[model samples]
Target: MLLSKAGVTAMLGLATLYTLLPLTWLLLSSTKSREDLFGTNGFALGGETHLAANLSHLFAADGGVYVRWLINTVLYAGVGALLASVFGVAAGYAFDKLTFPGKERLFSLVLLGVMVPGTAMAIPLYLLAAKAGLVNTFWGVFIPGLVFPFGVYLARVFSASYVPDEVLEAARMDGASEFRTFCRIAFPMIAPGFVTIFLFQFTQIWNSFFLPLVMLSDQDLYPVNLGLYVWYSSALTQGHPEDYLLAVVGSLVAVAPLIAVFLMLQRFWKSGMTAGAVK
Candidate 1:
């Protein structure tokens, strides 16, 4: 009943190509002018290249709004992911190692949180942020992303699998305080898990569309996705397709940071996943 190795290889090859197709289109589309983008075959090279000009207009548009959006995206994704990883790892460690009343029930609630659609919480989160006078502010978007239940769950999986009770007990047996043991011994052990969690949260917040759209009215507070949406919407309304072309180029530019992060940090994720799997 087992599949042949060639079948498996073919299946994997198809999956890889499927994943890369859209990205390939994005790269090609970004190099094209609006007229060419609309008229040309989707996968073909353009009649005339305009990547440099398009990027110039994308950056200079609306008084350099794209630059602001890029910076906002960095702050939102970077800081939110870091805090979410810290909280996730700490909560996960506690869940796996510590004895507490109603621990299972609490974790059930966390699982429920993980299952809840983020879109469903937008209004409620907006209301809460409004109540706290945080609406239209950086914190409104940043705060919601810091509590990632799925990240906590992932961390728990990593903790239970990667970290051993014996190592913790050995640290304790050496008269190491609980905090010191966790900081020195456990944190390094879970470093790969944290990187994985960080990338997850980073990608989530970076590509988030509706939550930031609901929470922040100011264009200055926008992540790249929302900012691009605004441009695309403006193009649709104004009957100018140039903005549409700009959005395509901007999308390509926005993804560069994520590609860089993966290129730099993928080693940690690969090693961590391998260790976790083998252990």
Candidate 2:
């Protein structure tokens, strides 16, 4: 028993170290200057202290393109996640509760969409957006991001678990319309589920690079991911090698919001997940 426990502890410790190693590297590397990056130890702080300098340079470079990208990312993630969660939960509730014609067939098609790779749809989406004069515009990214099939599926599962037909029927019996019942009763009951869906969709949209890459051409409209790719490519070729540090720092900045959001809403997230497990 002691040997088994010791072995498990060792394996868990190794796993934790493996997971944290890359983040540690990024943190230390972001603090280093170009000269220290190569000369100093990989894990140690560089002789020169220039984290503040690097951040200022990153903001100033290319007329503050990074700031624009940051704003665009927030817009895409925030608005898209809001729309996606609202629509997803509403559709899921309707699918679970309301009876209509061809509902199963339509849901089956949505499931098929879930099975399909998002990358495979990018070109077709781009073509459609071009025809609609949405390409290279904010709508190009926001519209596509709002259509999250996975979020819809999650909402359906959560609705089935969290929402009871009796409660809805009680609301209706109390002279509430369908929309009012959902707003007053069902919505509050499933608030945790809604937050879960929103966080999931927000992370997905924030990290997405391929669809934005195909949809928008203007650098001014690029999200942080695509903007970082631009700087990374330039740094790989002719630009200042120090730009690499900026890219790393920018990557950290881009990921900070997602982490903060998760931490803020983690309790709701856990409750939502566990709510359906037992009952």
Candidate 3:
């Protein structure tokens, strides 16, 4: 038993090291100047920290384009995730509670969407967006981001677990309209579920790369991830080591929102997952 415990502890230690080493390198690298970034060991700090200078360059580079990208990311991820969560939760609620024609078939389709990779759908979505004259526009990326099949799946499960049919029926019995009941009763009951879906979709849309790459042609519309990619790609060929530094600093900044969101909503996320597990 002692040997088994030691082995498991060792394995966990290795896993944690694997996960944090890259992030540790990124944090250390973000503080280094362009020369020291490439010169010093990745895990070591530079002789002089350049985080402030790197941040200034990052925001001021290319006529302050990185700021635009960051704003665009916030708009896309924030608005898109909120709308997607609402839509997903509503659809999940309908699936769990209300019955209509072809309901099972439609849910099967939603499940199929969960199985389909987002990259696979990106081309088709682009074609559709192009037909609608939305290509290269904010709506092009924003609209596609609102469709989160996994969130819908999670919502359905959460709805079934978190919300009770008895409570819904009582709401209806009390002369509440379907929409009213949902908004007042079911939604509150599923608040944790909503937070879970929101966080998941927010992270997904924030880190999204391919769909935007396909849909958007304008740099002004690029999200931070896409913007960093452009800078990093240019750096490799253009001999602009400063661009690499900007990319590294931008990466560290980009991770901040996800960390903040997870920290804020982690308790809700945990409760939502476990709340439905028991009777």
Candidate 4:
């Protein structure tokens, strides 16, 4: 099961290339003017540099609607991921620390939920949202995203490993209520786990397409991904290839914040992933 140094190095090199190749192409393509995009080599950066100009068109296009879509994406993914983390962590902690009837059966159901495909639920969810008169509203999409079964599973794994029984017992002996004990003592210990859940759900929600598409019909409620998709679809109808160019540029811009987030919060991994793996 051991690999030679050459084998390991070759594998690492291929993996790095596989991951970076698309990013490299996106960077090169984004630098081009509309004509240059098709005229030049796909991977080459030789083009009339118009990144700044493209961005200007991108923001000003369609009465500054892209900005609204950007805001919607931030609200949808950022808030939804954060709330998912909170609820998931709380549920996980409860599963680990609290005693109740049918707990194991309920958790087994949650695990089952993790195995269920989100697309399979889309039609049923749309039906329910329609019945509740929540369709095409912000809450319709936002509310559904807050449920993260995988995050709950991760949180439970983390809580069991991170939150020690002695600390909970000590908090109880000091007469702190269960909620207070969790908020004060247990939360800090599992904060890293919460961040892990947040990051995981953030990526999922940010990349979410099918759910948003099904729930929201209003252009104003569209997240960046769906909005860019609309522009891409209209690239030919508008008789301007730049709209297509803008979509590419917009995608490059859309992913930057997520990359920044990962860079900033990656340190939480040592505490969460390692502990979860052990447990």
Clashes of each: 0, 0, 0, 0
Error of 4 at 77 (Å): 0.6
Q: What TM-score fits each model?
A: 0.92, 0.92, 0.95, 0.93
Worst 10 residues of 2 by lDDT: 45-54
Give one digit per residue, the lDDT tens place, for model 4 in 51-75.
Answer: 7778888899899999999899899
Ranking, TM-score, top scorer first? 3, 4, 1, 2
Candidate 2 lDDT, 1-279, residue by residue in tens: 999999999999999999789888877777878778778989997433477777777899889999999999999999889989999888887888888999999899879989998889999999999999999999999999889887777777878888889988888888999999888877766777789889988998999999999999999999999999888887899766767777887887787888888998998777756765544
Best of the candidates, TM-score: 3
C-alpha lDDT score of every prediction, in listed order: 0.89, 0.86, 0.90, 0.88
Candidate 1 scores a C-alpha RMSD against the true structure in Å of: 2.1
Off by over 4 Å in 1: 1-10, 47-49, 275-279
Using alpha carbons, what is the TM-score of model 4?
Answer: 0.93
lDDT of 2: 0.86
Candidate 1 similarity to native, TM-score: 0.92
Model number with the top lDDT: 3
Per-residue C-alpha lDDT of model 3 across residues 1-279, encoded as one tens digit per residue = 999999999999999999899889888898888888888888888543388888888888999998899899999999999999999999899999998999989999999999999999999999999899999999999998889989889888988988999999998899999999999988877888899899989999999999999999899999999999999998999887778888999999999888998998898877766765653
Candidate 1: 10-residue stretch with minimal lDDT: 44-53
Cα RMSD of predicted structure 3: 1.7
Q: Please provide, for model 1 over 1-279, each residue's C-alpha lDDT reduced to its tens digit, 9 standing for 90 to 100.
A: 257888999999999999899888988998788888999999987533487778888899889999999999999999889999999999988888888999999999999999999999999999999899999999999999899999889888878878899999998999999789878988877888899899989998898999999988898889999999988998899887888888888988998999998888999888877876776
